[model samples]
Target: MSGDGIEILRLGARGDGVAADGLHVPGALPGERVRVGPAEERRGVRRAALDAVLAPSPDRVAPFCPYFGTCGGCAIQHLAPEPYAAWKRGLVVTALSRAGIDAPVAPLRDAHGAGRRRATFHVRRIDGRAEAGFMAARSHALVAIDHCPITEPPLHRAPEVARALARPLGGGGKPLDVQATATAGGLDVDVRGHGPADARARQALVALAGDLDLARLSLHGEVLVQRRPPVVPAGRAPLVPPPGGFLQATRLGEAMLADLVVAGVGEAKRVADLFSGAGAFSLRLAETRAVHAVEGDAGALAALDRAARATPGLRAVTHERRDLFRRPLLAPELDRFDAVVFDPPRAGAEAQAARLAEATVPVVVGVSCDAGTFARDAGLLLAGGYRLAEVVPLDQFRHSPHVELVGVFRREGRRRR
Candidate 1:
């Protein structure tokens, strides 16, 4: 512990304040003098807990959420809007600079419309009753809450629903994860962590779903009860996503990303949507151009196919179930599409990027939630003769360190090889 408070130099990737000596202080803002306890090294970085803020930064503001500090869900709720946007945008700029890719990074766009539509609440038996809420910051300890303010208004009751759902599976005995998604029909919930539910547990869950008037309830993707299909609208199509399916955190975030993707595709007659999840982009793109949606998840692909077939007036929407990581679409396979749009997981589409690098795809749009991985993949594309056009950063996960980005690339001349 330093007798004199340490000065915070900058914000780290994980929203922690970094001192000049490389000490990472949690809950400390840049340009602020913060007193921290003795540092301990974790994951190669020396970290300390912020004990006091001797001098507060101008960018610091009072957090709106009462549970902001205790809950692990949000990191930078105290930062003012201007500096917060700059910091979020800087994430993409810093990442691209580190990757040695010189590109025009746009300002941060707020896509957190109506807040997050989906949230995962951790359920555990505390004292005598089942409690549902988020985990404490940097700890496994649960912070029970009545509701989360950052979520959509409909999902404010998600914590209560999660608590009720956990009661059937021996609420006090085992820990459970309740993933709730606000859909058109109603709340779609999926419970995990508990093993296979027995006949009695299944009956209890089904009854509870009926009582709660839930759209659907599932255990590990297996439907326990479905009062109605959990439909989520993507553009003009109504999609019933698979149980525990991956979706953009916010409805507006999906639309924003899809808009960027469609605009990047331009006048392309054929497009390939790689790593497409439940046709978030494919169904939308299919309205104008022929789309070939490729994904590893069969359930997601099936949902996309069903939605596409049910919706009229959409151009041909073909799909394929392929593990892109294991076997990326080769150069020859990619030749048929005029443009390629890939929105991979946090790991990014390194293998697909390699293949796209070899291919002569006129236009390529890469959407990623991880800036570091996006920058790395952009480097591969740039090395393969693709000119980095523009990069847009979107803040969908408000008050959090996570930022989504969409990068546009165009093939210039020939490949380096």
Candidate 2:
């Protein structure tokens, strides 16, 4: 496969094309035959560069972003809509199949509307000017980008904002992590990787924030200056999230997940939202059901509590700041709620899922950004007598290899006494 060409059979889990002889070629799509260069083995798989495309797949399409082939920000942008959607949904299907959880998987939802609201840019000084953009695929080299179409219009201001704070934030000599989040008020910028800022640097950042008209700016988790609170809508209330807080990548994705969670819990009077981040699901569910929002982030919980209190006509929403991984709610404690919704991080909620598996809760909905972990946790629930009703995949991060899903599980028969 080195000197000769190889036929791309299918797209692998990492969005690379796999050949019949098991060679992985980046930038090659399925149903296409391509020539490959000498291979380098990484993680026990032979990876080769796509040298020439002798035949192109029908599903292949021109990428919208000029930086598509170089930037690691997106993969599969070259695919047509129909095949792209199929490949994305196939990720969840394969994961669940491997876990032996056979259930009805719904068609993938297009949650990539208007692009993502958050972007973490990589910034470094080159020559005398700051260069800000995404990293090249599987390399430390940075691809300087003038525009990013996959992000919201406000997030396109990241490069300018990064350049403004580069010098003041001590970013000349080292690379800086510039995380910009688009909020209702304005941009919320969080600068990391650079050393802590001093009083003088703090003053400079404050002035720069005003100049940029930024809503808030923080350095290494410390607020440098805040013109106004960065608010995100959660249900009927607006929540001023903590700097660098976890919110859905897109509002469209949040709405889809919330809708599924609400419908999964049905008309239950009481619901427990695990790993609730600023009440993305808790607050929405509270429109009808009394919600107990539990999370590990104290700041996020505080914001949720404030919103829950201020918002009128919502069912009581109580919050607890506890690490579910270290101390998950036990079966006896979980028995109080009729329905439970858990949206854990990429690692999934194994400890919590183990307990929820045995709990008497009639309904359990699992929301995950990782299909492998979701299937793993789903296996736990299935082994405990829970029936997996349905699994829905949502494409929140479009053109990227990552996939998000919501799984609904129900207890088959009588609850364990």
- Report every candidate's CA lDDT: 0.94, 0.89
Clashes of 2: 0
Question: What are the per-residue Cα lDDT tens digits for candidate 2 across 1-417?
Answer: 554578899999989999888889989999998998899997899999888999899888888898988899997788899988899999999999998879999999999888899988989777778889999988988888876889999988788888788878666567898899998999999998888767898898899999999999998877888899888888798887888888899989999888999999998899999999888899889889799999999988988998888789999899898999999999999999999999999999999999988888899999999999999999999988899999999999999989899999999875645
Local error of candidate 1 at residue 29 (angstroms): 0.9
How much lDDT does candidate 2 score? 0.89
206-238: candidate 1 lDDT, tens digit per residue:
999998889999999998888998999999999
TM-scores of all candidate predictions against the true structure: 0.98, 0.97
Instruction: List runs of model 1 lying over 4 Å from the truth.
Output: 415-417
Please list all clashing residue pairs in model 1, or write none if there are none: none
lDDT minimum window of 10 residues, candidate 2 = 166-175
